[model samples]
Target: MTYTHILTRPVRFFGFAALAALLAAIIFAGAAFGTTVFAAPIERTDVLIGFKNIPGFAEHTLVRAHGGAVTKSFHLVPAVAASLPSAAIRALERNPLVSVVEIDGEFTAIGHSVELDNTWGVAHVGAGSVHHDSVVGTGIKVAIIDTGIDYTHSDLGANYAGGHDFVNGDNDPMDDNGHGTHVAGTAAALLNGAGVVGAAPEARLYGLKVLNASGSGSFSDVIAALQWAVDNGVSVTNNSYGSSRDPGTLVQAAFDNSAAAGVLHIAAAGNEGNCPGNRNTVGYPARYASVVAVAATDKNDKRPCFSSTGPDVELSAPGVSITSTYLGGSYATGSGTSMASPHVAGVAALVMAAGEQSASAVRQILRDTAKPLGDSNHYGHGLIQAVAAVAAVGDSSPPPDDSEPEPEPEPAPEEPTDEPDTTTAVVSDISYSTSGGRTNDRHLTVAITISNGDGAPIGGATVSIDLHRNGSRIASGTGTTNSSGVVSFTLKNAQTGCYSTTVTDVVAEGAQWDGFTPSNEFCK
Candidate 1:
């Protein structure tokens, strides 16, 4: 969902209590000495700081010396969430150890109230048949990163493993707001024969409360929650909250790192749809390349006015008036891309439980088996079909074979020569270089090298690159590699900001292109 505008009000430093106590002591001492002492209030801003290297005690001490307090420190992403004086931000950005400094933007739950109704999404997405086949997402961990989950709810308690409350900084992640509970129910509610069941009724649920009762929270909290998910061995994360604004390199880095660690992230595309559906309205971290952006559809498989459409949207699911478990052991119906995301997540769990555990493999299986609807903008690969996806991995039971005539076995084909055909080619390295300082005069060049498995250069390979700045693809180019196995693409008049180049494809006549490890490079 599109977040409300970020909160810009000045905040007091995290050490304000200690500072006040010191001020009181100074005032008493000054009065005894027949003098008055005063301390100016420090106006701080919540920010996420990215480090060139993983931060340690020295870096934290530096922040404290500059009147900043570390709220959270991350291990995998090399970043820290802290509150610093507005004037100190520039100093930190200029620090040799710091890579980027950005204000922590706000994100919120995307769903709105709707009339109570039956849970039609499970059957609509073919989960009912899959459930009947006895593959109900058993032994899979799906983390719900939102307001929180009402684990005490009868339908969800059985699946609730445990959770952390980032908003309240505690272990109890109870949902004062109903959004997370409803979302959790749709993803992994229990099949206890009373209330509505989830798409993957047996998947374990972990509640990570990033947002508060008002359904809004800062980017720092979301990042910390994601880090927690990655650290705790979560298989998949259902992020039904987002902001239209780009959350800068720190958030993207967290998602990419988590994805690299085998955590599949699914998020809402947004509620900013249009009648024509021509605009790209997907929100971050959904817009990030590491996440699967989900679009919302109705019972008739029609895109709703509020469901955002974009190239980033990878899958669509039922979101309109879907009822699920709510706070206080109740149920509620809501509508938004938020409702659509958990459907995909639950199906993802089902596929994972059905013997496809790799995050990338599950993503491709879901895409390959989705029911296609016209217009990729409105419906990316159409609706997700749980049975087809599960069956694709050979997990579902086939129908019993009836009486049939025996047939002769076909002859086997001849074996090929031991050594022939193409050699395997892979991207050896990708590097970035920049020139010029003025806004309109800046230029960026990306060089990619391809080589074989033995590290020999693969010449004449066609390489394609997508140039991204600030998380959006701005330009793309294709060129053949030189005899030295290097292909360089330059963007003239590139704006000064975070830049990255991804090798979309590599082709050669006598060499098969094996996938390479992907990484990002920045010019700023």
Candidate 2:
């Protein structure tokens, strides 16, 4: 598709002819590169290119300069997205002007991934509390871009809307396979008699059928689904799919465009649990910047054997033995990164129903309020909690006290005092250590002494200490320097066993004879 944007420039008048030339250049550029290589099973032949900070004219010139043929571009996204031949891709990658170059490839649906013994997954994320407030995703819409959804299912039909079937090139989007209906149920199955309640029970669902009965589809179908979401004003898209080792291609631009257009794209982080064996290997689309990559967790908040782990994994949700709507308007249980993805997608809708409209804003609220577990790889910032996420969406806390940057060292007084008796105090001694004890009773010891410039002990200096436990402030106290110029702070009941937070940010103060920032601090 061709896009025209009338960007405003600085407060300078351009001659009519100069403005005309720029417009004509952009028009020619759009026409010259108006369609991507639409062939199936074609990789390495088409490439997706992105450019940033370059003006429209400059982008046009740069593409042509590298012999790059433009197919299509999503001007709404930060990077000017385009397609190029293999040779142009190499040249573009080598060029300083291009921001990112990725090979355009296809994506296949990766079949993959919660609890109350029967519905623990719903309680795991606290969606019940959100439902109590009537925030059951009443006004939100989530698209399931999978095999297809059985809209006829008693549990899902109430919320099911119309969607396109990319597999058969039709608009009916019915389920030939059961995967889409299963994922759809997890995302937003309706609250009806004799069925499981979804994470966001009232959220709308649409099946943008991409995968066929065998649970697979090409990259182009994925792109078409994304375009459909963008055009249809979809609030969230639950994509329980992926492509292993697929270099990012045309779909990357599509993901970016979808996000920029205010839609959230949630995807399974992949189910190759330890397939790379000790390395966190995330697959394509899910690993893209614009997609919310979700990992899988169980009732006990543990990573299952099949869920992938990596830095790209954003958040985790219940995905083990999950029960949801199925074929024949029935319900069944399944697992995979695919199952894990819908939990987050449902939460996204709940957050939206609570009045968070911006896609970026909803993402931040979810990340900020997620259950913070120590392990990031398995549970990317920890398991997602729906009640917390909902509360965060409507949070009106006092804005953070960003006014205080870390205190800088004070400069020596410029004005000399009349009672100047030259005295400089140095830390005569310093020591710190952790006391051995069981988890219930441990302590931290920090000590410091002040001495005069002449090597004599100083006295009466106010001493203060700040103690932190696990990245949060835990304790602080002030001590007066004794006659011997010594002051100490001991934190009792220090935590022992399992990820102990070491005492950090210990600072000492004197009467300005000398200031000290201890060396033990490893502030990042």
Tell me the TM-score of each prediction against the true structure. Answer: 0.70, 0.58
Flag regions of model 2 displaced more than 4 Å: 1-104, 113-117, 275-277, 397-524
In Å, residue 516's CA in model 1 sits off its true spot by: 38
The CA root-mean-square deviation of candidate 2, after full C-alpha superposition on the true structure, stands at 29.0
Supply the global lDDT for candidate 2: 0.67
Q: How far off is residue 5 in model 1, in Å?
A: 39
What TM-score does model 2 achieve against the real structure?
A: 0.58
lDDT tens readout by residue for model 1, 304-413: 98889889999999999998999888888889899999999999988887777799999999999999987888899989999899888754565412111112321111
Give the 10-residue window scoring lowest on summed lDDT in candidate 2. 1-10
lDDT of 2 by residue, 173-280 (tens): 889888889899888887675688889988768789988888887565677677768766688999888888765544677788789899998999998867433567
